[model samples]
Target: MEDVGLNQGQVFLSQNVLITPKKGDTYKSSRLSALDLQRGLIMCLMAFSHCRDYVSSVPNKNLSWNSPLIEQNISSLDFLQKSLISLVAAGGFYMMMGIGIFLLWQSRIKDGVNPKTIRNYLVCRGFVLVTVQFTVLALFETIAEGQFYLYVGVLFSLGICMMMAAWVMYGVELLKTKSWFGFSKIEYWLPLSLGLIIILFSHGVIWSNHHYNISPDVLQIALLLGGEYHTPMFFIDINFTPFPWFPSVALGLIIGKIVTTKKEKAWAPLCALAFIFLTIWFVIRTANIQGLFFFGDYKTISPNSAPLTWQSYMSISKFPPSLTYFLWSWSINLLGIVWWFKLEQIQPKLFTSFKALKIFGQNALFFFIGHWFIYYGLSIALPYHLTTLTGIITVWLIGLIILLPLCKRWYQFKSQKNKNSLWRMF
Candidate 1:
């Protein structure tokens, strides 16, 4: 939520001009409509993923749980759907966050906001996100699951990544002020450099724990660094870790900078870059080259389970996402951006026709919070599990239907000039 989209009272830019609207007012910026639509699409996919988790009877294990990947017990279609969602959903969200933050920063600069003031504001927002994750979200999950565990989830990770990005921005500013670096455009290289470093070193850092027998304190630190955590009483799994996700945010920042700075021509080069990355990803995955991390051969309990093929190659590690995972996921996101850009150009009305999805995109934080409660209530009242794809889609559509009005109402409330309550934090 920290980087989901515009804040409650923030005045965003439409093209290069600053539009100062009333507090909580929505700006009809067509340029950013594509982003909202993309976010909406991501939310739908996320709902489907959650539907599978709550409704499906199949036991879904982590793709990277064993030395070799385990062949999924699910049907081929289910496996494919889950695989794509697992790879792209979370990474896409983080990338969007990065893009959102950059846009926010650019808008603030256009409004003559001081750099320090902007940084402080972002820092506060980041802290609020982290707090909400541990408190509001944690409470919801505890109530739903009937268990009390400190779930450091996506919001927490996003908050931490925001703070990191803020520092990185500050560092870039400092470098620009100095003549020693001899580079005026350090911002262009910083995000990619930092992202590549994190991706390349993640596996080695995790491996060192096994060889050297890291202490509990050190292990806890490693867990924060995206290392696997498994304990009888407490587990800090990679899915919930923040470190591995930082790279996604970083990469997103790079794209965001390009979009905000380059304008219309950005998409062509970005699309080409994404295709190039996708090509490289295919080559590396097919050859089983360890550019960032090595994946083991897939093992299956049943002989009839899904075979190890290109699809299997596509099912890379996600918890601590490998380089290949980042490339594939971000490539899809970039291509989606290109596709949406073209669609928006050809038929803006057609692209914006899905009012419900655009609403969901605008009020993502509210929907995300509310949907969990909806799922929890449904799971309790229905007390039925659905195994087939049709059943899963049904449940997901039901969720969307249930959420649409709530999201719409909340969006209306949030858009009101007088409603400046803390509830707007969502």
Candidate 2:
């Protein structure tokens, strides 16, 4: 569950900030109490992780398989605990992207928000997300990948998710309007079917081999529909299309229906589902199957060192969002959602201290893009060896603290500007 692409969800923390309404908005997307709480948790972790990333004194915590080049300085238990926290935050963030989309659809159905309005905003947002990342994130990747290149990540993932969510909502509406489905039926099964279809089609044999590359055109597929994975070296290939990933969006599509049900503590089940999914994925991944996603030299390094496992198998589906990927990512999302609800009663104040984290979650594209320049751009200005544990932690903590106020200011500006704008309708 490296989820490098999930950043597009702006869900690096949950997409709740993106989906939920600002107090200033004329059209409000009712806040998910869970999202706010979860969001706070997600943002805080982002900051903590970043801080841990840069500090000089502490040891690195190696948990999860994403890093083949490094091992954490921390002890095993510390790494495991930190890793689990990151997973909940990361997984919940993506699931929230799906939840946000689902809620938007429901809001349109029940409230005054027009489909055209939502569609237009998404179209515009999609463009922004892409351009921002290409400018910002691509630059960062160049540090490792060399030169500016397209990385179809979370911003890209979300742009694609938004576009797909629009179409899915449109189809849902069309079905309702045409009398092809009844209200009662639509409520229960439309979303359920959508979620199931996406999982089945994506995980099933029909779409299995359809992987693509990360490039400009390939990314466009992520926006318009779902996308398949391709070689990191190439941008497009036939095996790749925005197929299975659409299903993840579709699965998120179901989240809207579930939220709208107004059942007491309805959020609990989503959390439970996430927990169950993560537990299962963790168990299965222990067998080394999940590591299939690491289809590279990294796999040979051994799971103990490289963190490779069969759960890594979903690495392929990340673009189209393979079955294992969906279960793994979505399940974490579910748990985040469920946990937030419980956290809300206590209304933890620690969440706000990390409000700077939400700045990225809010207008993720800007922070994502901006951070790259700061991360790499500044490196050019203040050259240093980042390979050492101290250098990395120093950079991360300095970035988080400095960015806090900057992010807060941006959040205020964006929140105010978007309120009157038609963009708030979503």
Candidate 3:
């Protein structure tokens, strides 16, 4: 939603100061309401997970139930639930982005843009993402090995997703216009299912990276999720593969088109289907089926490693997501959508205090840069052992306390300006 940019000052100082095309206004959409909710939660989860992973004494850094964090407990079902929550939390953003691209693609066509030229230019965006990724790496990668900068993080993934979105939109137009797959409901569900299947395998590959070295895995995971940080760029991130993830954009387009333009009353059935799949996930994971009949070299390589059938079950190598990882995260996101529609009222009181939380969520990219920059600089200049679970919770709370009141007016202004719409996607 933001970059390492100038709004940094105005965003912090004023309550109702309008960010002039300064990225504060763009990408605000009702469609992203649920998506932003999902992104904010996942981004926080990412911060916590990374903090724990880098910090010692947390036991299970990735926030996985399989980790010692849960294993140490007598009955650690909570870890499992957390893992599931983490898994599904982040994927919605990509799915939403894909959907956005699809809509844009359609709109562009309607507005008389050449499809081929648009596709080529869109793919070029990947290079731009790679360019920015390397710039960040050069600026920040201080360590020799295992440095976070070796591979791209979140932004790179979206870049590739954007490129993929262009392609997928082309396919959507082709399929629907050609009737190759009958432009009915089947077209929507088919691509969605295919993307989910590819992501499952990609998830397995990504976990393998954590067990050993990630330099090789980085490319695979990057490609899987859309982009990675490998300079040579030969080894693609397979975990977040373009094959499936791109199609998800097409699928999202179809769904969005159906919902907004078609005005179809199809969500009730979709909600029912989501419940069915969710029930299955609960039953299987709860029964302790790690989805592996025999744990292979997973344990041998890294005791922390387990048979990863679900990508979201683990830390999910961020730059790119695996098949299982992408699906799991999106699955939870889908669940959120259903809940938002079906529940009508989900503890509105909970959402009230969440005003502060919602601000951090909305301005996540800025918040991430701010916190990480602060954390990294502070840790280097004046390192502290204040990152244990207690410290993290304290820091989390303290950070929110400091940021909330300071940033509340800006949020209030944004809320008032764009008061009626739920998601603020330009």
Candidate 4:
């Protein structure tokens, strides 16, 4: 991250390189306030989406293969709203994780940490996350729904992505050590290349599920390959898989390299890059390109019964995020980063109003775990009706208001704990 400060309507980047803040004024941060804000906002959106899941009478048709069409026709505005809602939750979170990992890697390198040590940490962290996902998160879901099922969700995907990133880093380092190859630039493009290859083949991988006669146990592997599968015995539900989503993290690695390498006028080039992504997204989405494997057919107001309305177009599949879906979600998220950068440069004090969001953002892992328990407990204890959109929104707001303080306190407690303690994994 760039060292940014605002002094006399001028923005100073790292090394005291000063340029006039865009539009003549901006705020600044010792840490990356923009990232905190983006992460905070993503958490809030996720809370809303999850709350809707738990409480709304209408099942998320997007999640069901045999869902019926919604009686109420969706308008363009409604489609846009739904798109934004979906984008922030998973898409934003994964991309930010990528960015965060890259930043952490840079910090570790600067602190003289050995590659082996860093790799160990990454591997340990990934295993811890996977363990938590299956045990803690699955337990919470089972409790909330009063069912016994192993749910492989976002955390599982994230854990896999982390491990993959670590290995990619290790490969780059290995290549760097080889005198004959002399492929120094491999470190920069390795993640991006791997990500693109995975994405390009993702559609074919998922589609192959139909042709294979694999056993149920072996079929469960689809959970990691961007396809949803379940076992009768375990009742395992692979809702969010790692295959398609890992690319976001890879792209984030590329972006992180850019941010670190281009300290001066970094935001300018980033903003331009964001525009390019947005343009590609628009073209792919509007044209309904077929080779991209966009789930326009599945993303209807109801599943398998669509004339392909605007809502259908906007509500792209998330279980296995399509190429268009990735383009759309990531482009918007990139633009958001640019927006936050500009906002930080202009109105630093304005961030004070979002103190609770910042706290939640900073302590995301804690909040992610804690919020589920809180929501599940409330669902069991309270007899509140939350069938309507207004009711769902109310509950979501209440969760935020209550969880904000809890998250802040938890963050403070974690800070007081030993930095080297295993509990730091939260």
If scored against the real structure, what TM-score would every candidate get? 0.84, 0.65, 0.61, 0.82
Best by TM-score: 1
Error (Å) of candidate 4 at residue 358 is 1.3
lDDT of 2 by residue, 117-144 (tens): 7666556655555565455656566564
In candidate 2 the C-alpha lDDT for residue 118 amounts to 60
Question: Which regions of candidate 4 are displaced past 4 Å?
Answer: 1-31, 59-81, 179-184, 207-221, 224-234, 289-306
Query: Local error of candidate 3 at 205, Å?
Result: 9.0
Task: For candidate 3, write residues 56-86 as lDDT tens digits.
Answer: 2334324321232123332243355346544
C-alpha-based local distance difference test score of model 4 = 0.64
Off by over 4 Å in 1: 2-28, 58-61, 65-67, 70-72, 180-183, 207-238, 289-307, 417-424
lDDT of 2 at 248: 55
Candidate 3 CA-lDDT value = 0.46
Give the number of the best model, judged by lDDT: 1
- Candidates 2 and 4: which is better by lDDT? 4
What is every candidate's alpha-carbon RMSD to the true fold?
5.1, 8.4, 8.5, 6.5
Give the Å shift of residue 186 in candidate 4.
Answer: 2.5
- The per-model lDDT (C-alpha) reads 0.68, 0.48, 0.46, 0.64
